[model samples]
Structure formats: structure tokens, C-alpha cells
Target: MHKKVLNRDRASFFVITLPALLLYSFFYIYSVVLGFYYSMTDWDGLSRKFNFVWLENYGKILKNKAFFNSVTVTFRYAILMVVFTIVIGVLLAVALNSVKRFKTFFKSVFFFPAMISSVAVALIWDQVFIRALPNLAPLFGVANIASPLGNKQLALYAVLFVNLWQSLAMPTVIFIAGMQSIPDELYESAVIDGASMFDQFRFVTLPYLVPTITVNAILTLKGGITSFDYAKALTGGGPARSTMLIGIKIYIDAFGDTPKFSIANTESVLLFLVIALLSIVQLTISSRSGVNKA
Candidate 1:
């Protein structure tokens, strides 16, 4: 009777999960396999027939200077985004957590930007950079200041600023949660030991938030690499391609006037590999840190 019931329970579980498993296989597994196959071909994205020039697409991408430049831009932006997001997020979270009154209201206010779509944020910021800031410049005795989006030297930073504005909400929330998760006894012990506020934060709070930092780092890094809407809606890789991130480069290669779908797919595969590798490294480091802390 027990054996029969176990078999029946296993069957029921499979029946319930089969649909989701099938969807995953179709959407994720099958699409990835198909994309990998396409990456080795010379398909122009519209042709019914194509030759598989195995690994040639990968070689071409390696030699392509534009692709390299995009990768460089992406890494630079991603590193900056990760660093700034952690720092500002922790600071903002600490501030919000310290608030005795209106704490919930403050968090909601800060998170409001994230509720808006990226394209909408970019559009609104685009207007601010192009018209509002430029128009208001003369009031400060400055005349004819060009928008950062139109300036090659400052365009990337401008885009980073806008992206960071919207990206902070979730990280801040995570940091706040991390702070809250720390036991009151820890803070009480520190107080009894005569530790200053800064000392308590450094020893008690920061040590506890290492895992939170790791989580935010991975998220921000991925978001920075995959960012497309802001670049598209705000500058469109404008001025002189100063803000031509890898995602935008892949997109253009895939759907430009001369579409190179194979190359685009190759880039996508490489990007996936990069993200996976980085995430693994992050997790490994985090695990080591946790072990050490324990």
C-alpha cells in the first residue's frame, strides 16, 4: 500500500509540473540550442538558405574593432554601475532605515522611478538634458551649453547617471532588508561595548551585508551589460558612438540596414557566457566569504 501511494504521488507531481517543464524546454532550452546553431552560420537574417561557416563568425567578431569597442564600453559602464549602485544604495538605505517617521513613505518615493518604464525614464531625462538644462544654463551666466547627450566626452556619463537613478531602488530595498535582518542583540552588544555609530556600522552592519552586496553586484552588472532602452531612447548611440554599449551593438548588427544575424547571435552567445562566468565567480566569492564569516 505504501509503495503504491508513493508511486501515485510521484505521478501526480510529474503531471502538475509537466506543463511548466515543457514551456521551459521550448522557450529557453530549444531557443538557446537554435541560437547556438545560428551563431555558426552566415545567415543574413532574411534568407531561406545559408551556409554554416563554422567558427568563422566567432573569428570575425574577435577581429571586429567596433565589437571590441562596444565590449570595452559595456565593461566600463558595468563596473561603474556596480560600484556606484552598492555605495549609494547602502548609504540611501541606511538613511531610510534611520528614519523614525515616514520610513515607508520615503522608500516608496525613492522606488517610484523604478516603477516607471526605462524608455519613459529615458524620454523624460532626454528632454531634461536637451532642453531644460540647456535653457536654464544662461541663468547661471553660462551660455549655449550643449547637452551631454550631444557631447562625445560626457554622453556616457550622462546615460550612466540616468540609468543609476532608476536602478537604485531595488538595491536600496535589499540593503534596507539586510539591515533589518541583523538582530537587535548585535547592536545592543556593540553599544554596551562602547562602539561609536560608525564603528558599529563598519563591524556589525557591513559584515552582515556582504551577501546583500554580492546580490546587488550581480544584478547591477547584468543590468548594465544588457541596458538598451536608455541608450536607444536617450542618445541612440549618438554624438560619436561614445555610448554604444554591447547590447545596442548586438541589436544593430541583428537588424541594421545590412543584417548579420549570425554575428548578432554569436555576440549574444558570448554575452551569455560572460554573464554566466561572472555570476559564478561572484557566487563563489560570496560562498567563500560566508564560510569565512561563519
Candidate 2:
């Protein structure tokens, strides 16, 4: 009877998960396989006849200076995004967790931006950068520095700033939960030992929150690397392609006026490999650190 019950439970679990598994396989796994096949071809995305060019697409990528520039921009954006988001999120989380009044209200306020569509956020900020800031600049006796989004030197950072407004929300919530999970007894014990608040945070809170930070770091890093909507809508990879992220470049290569679907797929494959490698390295390091801490 126990054996029969175990079999029944396993069957039920498979039944519940089968649909989702099938969908994932069809949409993601199948698409990736197809992309690999297409990457070796010279398809213009709309072509009926195409020739397989093997690794030629990737060879072209190596010689493409614009592509390399996009790579540099992407890594720069991702690194900055991950650092700022984690640091700011932790600070905001710590502040909100310590507050006794309207804590829920503040969290909601911060989290609200995450609910808005990235394209909508871009549009809203574009207006602020174009119109509102210029109008208010004179009041502060500051020279009207018009449109950072139009300035090649500042466009990338401007987009990063907009992304942070939305991306900080989830990480902050994660940090808050990590902080709250620490038992009150630990704080009391620290106080008994005459440890200052800073010491308690550095020794107790941070050590305990390592796992949470790892989780947030992976998320922020992935988001930064794959960011496309804000770049597309806010700057259009403009100011002479200064903010042309890898994702955006892949998109334009595939869909822009001179479509090169083969090149785009090759770029996509390279990006996937990079992301996979980074994720593995990060997870390995984080696991080792966790084990050492334990």
C-alpha cells in the first residue's frame, strides 16, 4: 500500500508540472536550438533562401568595432548597476526595517516603480530630463544642462540612473526580509556585550545576510546585462550609439533596416554563454563562502 501511495504521489507531481515543463521546452529550449541553427546561416530574417555560412557570422563579430563597443558598454552598465542597486537597496532596507512608523507605506512607495512598465518609466523620465529639469534649473541658480540623455558622455549613466529607480525595489524588499529573519535575541546579546549598532550590523547582520546578498547580486547582474527596454525607449542607443548595449545591438542587427539575423543569433549565443559562465562562477564562489562561514 505504501509503495502504491508513493507511486500515486509521484504521478500527481508529474501531472501538475508536465504542462509547465512542456511550455518551457517549447518556448525556450526549442528556440535556443533553432537560434543556434540560424546563427550558422546567412539569413536576413525575412529571406526565403539562405546559405549556411558556418562560423562566418562569429568571425564578422570579432572584426566589428561597433559590436566590441557595445560589449564594453554592456559590462560597464552591468557592473555599475549591480553595485549601486545592492548598496542602495541594503541602505534603504536597513532604514525601513529600523523605522517603527509607516514602514509598510514606505516599502510600497519604493516598490511602486517596479510595477510600472520599463518603457513607460523611460518615457516619463525622458520628459523629466527634457522639460522639468531645465525649467527648474534656473531656480537653483544652476546652468541649465540640457538633456543628459542627448550627451554621449552622460547618456549611459543617465539610463542607469533611470533603471535604478525601478530595480532597487525588489532587492530592498529582499534585504528587509533577510534582516527581519535575524532573531531579536542576537541583537539583545550584542547589546549586552556592549557592541555598538555599527558593530552589530557589520558582525551580525552582514554575516547573516550573505545568502540574501548573493541572491540579489545574481538578479541585479542579470537584469543589468539583459537590459534593453530602457535603452531602446530612453536613448534609442543614441548620442552616437554610446548606450548601445549588447542586447540592443543584437536587436538592431536582427530587426533594423539592414537586418542581419545570422549575426544577431551569433551575438545572442555568445551572450548566453557569457551569462551562463558568470552565473556558475558567482554561484560557486557564493557557495564556497557560505560553507566557510558555516
Candidate 3:
């Protein structure tokens, strides 16, 4: 009877999860396998008959100056986004959590940007930078206040600023939750021990939030790497490709006039590897920090 019930339970669980598992396998696993194969071939994404040229796509990426530039821009955007978001997120979270009045209102205000679609956010900022700023510049007696998307020197920074604005809410919410989850007694103890707020944060609050930081790091890494919609909607990889991130480069390679599907696949595979490596490195650091704290 026990064995029969156990088997029935297993069957029920599998039945419940079967649809999702099947979808995941079909969409994710099969697609990855297909992409990997395609990455080894010279498929033009149009011609049905394509030749398999192993490792050539990968080798080509190394020598491609445009691809190298895209990588540099991506890393620059990711680092700036991650650092600014962490600092601003923690500050906002701390303030919002500590406040007594209008806390709910402030939270909603800060998170409202996140509720907006990325495309919409980008468009809105695009208008501000391209239309409004230029017009307002003359009023302020400022010269050359044009769209950063059109200026090679300022395009990347413009994209970074807009992306940062759009990406803050989730991390702030997570930091707030982390702060709240910490026991009140810890803060009280620190207060009694004559520790100021900064000291308390360093010793009590910061230590407790390490796991949250790890999760946010991974989230930011993913966000930074695959950031396409905002960049596309805002800059469209313009001003001589100054703002062209690797994701944009992949899209252009895959879909542009000369659609190099295999090259796109190669870029995709490299991106996946990069993300995986960064994730592992973050996990290692987090684990080591946990051990040291223990």
C-alpha cells in the first residue's frame, strides 16, 4: 500500500510539471542545440544549403574590430550600471525603509519607472534628450546641447543613464526587503553599543545583505548583457556604432542586410559563456565571503 501511494505521488508530481518541462526542453534545450550546430556552419539565414565551417566563426570574432568595440561598450555599460544601481539602490532602500511618513508613496514613486515598458522609457528619454534638451539649451545660454544618441562622445553615456534610470526599482526593492528581513534586535544592540548608523550598517546591515548582493549581482549582470530594447529604441547603435552593445551587434549580424546567422550564433554562444563565467565568479566570491564571516 505504501509503495503504491509513493508511486502515485511521484506520478502526480510529474503530471503536474510535465507541460512546463516539455516546453522548456523544446524551447530552450532544442534551441540551444540547434544554435550550437548553426554556430559551426556558414548559414546565411536565407540559403537552405549552408556549408559547415567549424571554428571559423569564433576565430573571425576575435579579429573583428567592430565586435571588439561592441564588447568594450557592453562592459563599460555593465560596470557603470551595476555600480550606480548598487549605490543608489542601497541608499534609496535605506531611506525608504527608515522613513516614517509617506513611505508607501515614495516606494511607489521610485518603482513607477520600472512599471513602464523599456521601449516606452527609452522613447520618453529619447524625446527629452533629442527634442527638449536642444530647445531648452538656448534658453539656458548653453551651446551644443544636442542628443547624445547623435554624438559619438556622449551616446554611450546617454544610453547608460537612461538604462540606469529604468533598472533601479527591482534592486532597490530587494535591498529594502533585505534590510527589513534583518532582525530589529541587531540594530538595537548596535545602538546600545554606541554605534552610529554608518557603523551599524557596516557591521550589522551590510553583513546581512551579502546574499542579496549576490542575487542582485547576477540579475544586473544578465540585465547588462542582454540590454537590447532600451539601446535599440534610444540609440539604434547610431553615431558610427559608438553605442553599439554586443547584443545589438548580434542582432545586426543576424538580421542586417548580409544576415550572417552563424556569426550571430557564435556571438550568442560567447555571450552565454561570459554570463555563466561571471555568475560562477560571483558565486565563488559570495561563498568565500560567507566563510570568512562565519
User: Against the unseen true structure, what C-alpha lDDT does each candidate score?
Assistant: 0.91, 0.92, 0.88
Best by lDDT: 2
Estimate candidate 1's alpha-carbon lDDT, on a 0 to 1 scale. Answer: 0.91
Q: What tens-digit string does per-residue lDDT give for candidate 3 at 1-294?
A: 999999999999999999999999999999999999999999989998999899999999989999889988888888878888888888888889988999999999999899898899999999999778888887889885777788898888888888878889999999999898899998899999999989998998888888888788789978898788888988888778888999999999999998999999999999888988988988888876741365
Q: Against the true structure, what is each candidate's TM-score? A: 0.96, 0.96, 0.95
Give model 1 RMSD, 1 decimal: 1.5
Per-residue lDDT of 84 in model 1: 94
Residue 275 Cα positional deviation in candidate 2, in Å, after optimal superposition:
0.2
Backbone clash count for every predicted candidate, in the order shown: 0, 0, 0
Q: Candidate 2 local accuracy as lDDT?
A: 0.92
Question: Between candidates 2 and 3, which one is better according to lDDT?
Answer: 2
List runs of model 1 lying over 4 Å from the truth. 291-294
Candidate 2 similarity to native, TM-score: 0.96
lDDT of 1 by residue, 5-55 (tens): 999999999999999999999999999999899999999898899999999
